[model samples]
Target: MDLSGGTLEIVVSAVVISISVPGNILLIYCTRRCIDEQLRTSFTLIFSLAWTNLIYNLVVNILKIVYASNVELDSAVCKVLMFTAVFTTSLAIWFTLYIALLFCSKLCRVVHPPVEAACKNYQKFHMVLVFTLWVAGVAVCCPVLLYTRRIEKLNTENETYQQFSSLIYTECKTEYRNDLIEILYGKIFLGAINLLPLLIMLLTGFRIVYLLWEHRKATYGGIWIGGDASELEVVRACKIILLLIFVITSFCVSYFSLVYCLKNFKSCYFAPPVLTVLSSGYSSVSPYLLMLINYKVIVRMRCFCCKDEKKLVTVSAIAPVSPYA
Candidate 1:
């Protein structure tokens, strides 16, 4: 069914906000409650990712929904909004890349167990790395803040401007004022920021999957035998990382599709809705992917829910030996 731009944007934003906000919050809460220092350090990228997506959904998507109905906004406000959205989106992608790299590093440990100790040493520096990435995202997108200007055009003879409302309409667009600069920004700068992370993600993702498969084939034989808690932990961690890769893969597909549409069908009626879905889909779906990582959370809660029963199980697992006379 065909839907209006405003309707489509609002629907997509509403769905994203509903899932991202609470899911990120729960992720943050659970991460904080975690007692293992190593595990918490491992989640540094994840926690940052959840935080970035939460802000993007709450601030950018909400504003997009409000502005969808052709409300006039000041040029400065428009630039700030657009810049923030782009910055957060880039930040989110970079964080996902970082996570992919982290998992790949962990997967390497399965092949070279001695490397595990070295990997653990770097865990202490993850927060610093995450902070640097946040700074880098802002710096990379700084051109957006400087070059964007909201322009309003009359819809008289030429139909370059889409109908936003019954009256005047404005759009935030890059105005580098130089053909060379605009071309560089569009082709080089934009491609680096948007496509580079995606390439890294795909590379790291495939390596991670391959390493995981090889590890499983050599170790587990595709079945979990009893009394191997470490094996269980490795399986759970791999599942969570796989879920994250799925989210990134989806974003890569959606984003490139939208980019292709913009280049070829700039004036298509479906562009706006496609843009809306492309921008918001990953943020929306990733949180639920995170919610699925609650396997650890469930196990933690189970320990509290039936402590005595668990203790009994542990005790009974050991067979009693009779003394001979």
Candidate 2:
């Protein structure tokens, strides 16, 4: 097959898959070995996001490959793939915000949680919170699947855009069935899936930072650092790294989402392959950055697998007898 688009899709998707698969697995391992329960929920959210990103990258890339190779799927399969790809990415970002909030709560102690700290039952509350997030992501995705369709078309020179599966069918000249209700449905997806949640995440991060400063904590660095005061130096280091990564990742995601939405209105807009690779690269970089800059995490890592060495000399001496005895 003379496949230019397929090549581009594979190149971009390959980068996404390669980075995400191992990155998530390693992040899961790191989380498992961590002993500090203080940031457990935050790390759990990161872990969940990393793993979900892996799944999304794998599924979407495989479909990209299969579809690029001219493989066809029924409406049901198309619906499932689109729903999953869109939903899971949203889930990853939403849960990541929850991660940020969990940390901010610790730093600012803003909303006192119903459960006590790091108790066995704490996980119960955690599950409820995470599940609600998952449900919300899926619910938002429903509109995307309803509005979108897997389409095939031929441009000049018989060049095909098969994997350009999603299209605004309202203006499609061919006899492919288009529904007015679905167009309205597209607006729902455009707002809910892409715009509203994104705005919420951005605002949540800002509110968290503001609250931290307002409370007179997180002055030099981030919201909170609860351990040894002397360790505050290391904590400050970690905070700088984390905040920088968070800011960068947020910008990339926002930029990509804005472009994706604006481009969707027309037949085809800019699909810069390089930008796709850059967006996909974020997943791989995030976890390593965490491990690299987090001093407490590193200390805990050493504790998990290593024994303390405090070698010393011994001297023997006789004890004096008690006068009464």
Candidate 3:
């Protein structure tokens, strides 16, 4: 049995929504509650990324479901969907890169006291930086609003339409005013959102790895005595950051490769479902990974569970003390 393109899209969208919605909501709730005076700037970035992912999943996937059902939607719906997809994805990528840079700065601070002093000053401007990213994303993706239009299938019996229908949504498509505009916009959009950020992440990830290796060698050689718990936590967080870089990089590479194939070779029938997975995969997955290294969130959850367990123990003749407490 073979599924149509619409069916494939609906299945993929549904799965992404199921995972992304709850994960992002919980991530947002946890990060919001954990924010404080000292960690305000850092957790703010996490909160923003979670918020962006949740919005993307809700807007894009819901619209995709409606479109895939073959319901006749207005051209504006297509424009909103495309614009949201591009804008949200760009914001998510830049936010993740921001996080990697934050970790790199911390590691540099450890290696050079002057760098740490500079980072302390830089922290004051983080909110402004975040605002700028949002504005920049809007500027880059605004053109998409004008170019995207509803794709109409006028003749159902057309051989070309039947052949390529499995690979594209019959309701929405993007068309620039001219080839030059399309080429120019494509290069700038791809470079800014995907290629350049990916390159920076890779470089930052390498710097983090080298710093950790150096720290470990020093600790083992007895140059640094009795590693502090905070230092250990930083090491753990850096490792998680490396994992995140890997996840985002893999998805980025897969998405662009499939997109290239679809554009160049018109017979890429399997591209739709795979492209859907690649497009939303990182957004759906990264929140949970961030939660793993969030000590405050972990502690709060444990305390909540312990309280529930204590409530159950009240019915017993003798209550057991919780290890968590």
Candidate 4:
């Protein structure tokens, strides 16, 4: 079915707010509750991304909803809303890149962490890094605030609205200025958000793949039984990171496609199937990926729902203890 822009906006808003808000809240709680410090650090990064997405989605979609409802805003509100959305979207891109890096480090097994003496230093570095990225996002989106302008309407009712659509100019600046700045922004996004991270993610993944291959070929008898499983686990994690990159980058590319398409071909705004699916697919699909990859979250979800059921199974079944548990 062809959904109107207003309908689409509301649907997207509902889905993102419902998913990201609660999902990220739970993620933050889980990260804080993790007993393993290293595991907690990884979960913390994921939680940070989740938090960013939640806030970004809520703010952006609210503005979108208001605009879709034909609620014109003053300059100050426009500036703040636009800047917040752009800044947080930038934050989301870099946060995903950071996650890809973390996955790579794990795969390399070169993540030989520092001694206990340097734990504070290590955490401090992470804090500084995340702060730097947030600051950079703010800086990148600063120009957005300048685009703020009061949008006025002559006739905003029924037949008058349809006739006056051409007269309405809510955009802050001339098309030329917006285009030039957005072009620069586009290049930066293509490089920083898509190209750079994709390269790093791919490079690290294949390096780990070669390393795993070398380790597996060493023809030790008993090593295959134990070492093989560990290697396989690492490979599995590598696959997850690779899949993560695909899902993450696919969203970036899809939006870029929409931007370019909208720029060159305005007629597509009538809710082309490709455009509609691409637009909706990002928020619709991302939560599934995040939940799937977070092994702990998966465990938590089951335990969250069926804590009593688990006990019943343990008690009812015959207790057969091997040397292991």
Candidate topping TM-score: 3
Model 2 segments more than 4 A misplaced: 1-4, 35-39, 72-76, 110-123, 143-149, 152-185, 207-275, 278-281, 292-325
Could you tell me which residue pairs clash in candidate 3? none
Query: What would the per-residue lDDT of candidate 1 be over residues 1-325, giving only the tens digit for each residue?
Result: 1255456666776877887787777776655564255455455666788888888888877777777756677678767777878788888788877766765665565444563345225555777788888898888788888888877754576453354231111366667878998778856887788778787787777787787777666666744332244434444565676777777667666776666545644345455556666777777777656544434443434444477873523211322210000
248-295 in candidate 3: lDDT tens per residue?
A: 899987777666645643234455566778888998999988886557
What is the lDDT of every predicted structure here? 0.64, 0.53, 0.74, 0.54
Minimum summed lDDT over a 10-residue window in model 4 is located at 316-325
C-alpha TM-scores of all predictions: 0.80, 0.65, 0.87, 0.70
Predict model 2's lDDT versus the native. 0.53
Positional deviation of residue 69's Cα in model 1 after best superposition, in angstroms: 2.0
Q: What residue runs in model 3 are displaced by over 4 Å at the alpha carbon?
A: 1-4, 111-121, 154-170, 264-267, 303-307, 311-325
Best by lDDT: 3
Candidate 2 lDDT over 104-169, as tens digits, reads 544443322245545343655886888788777777666656654645555545234433332222
TM-score, cand. 4: 0.70
Clashes of 3: 0
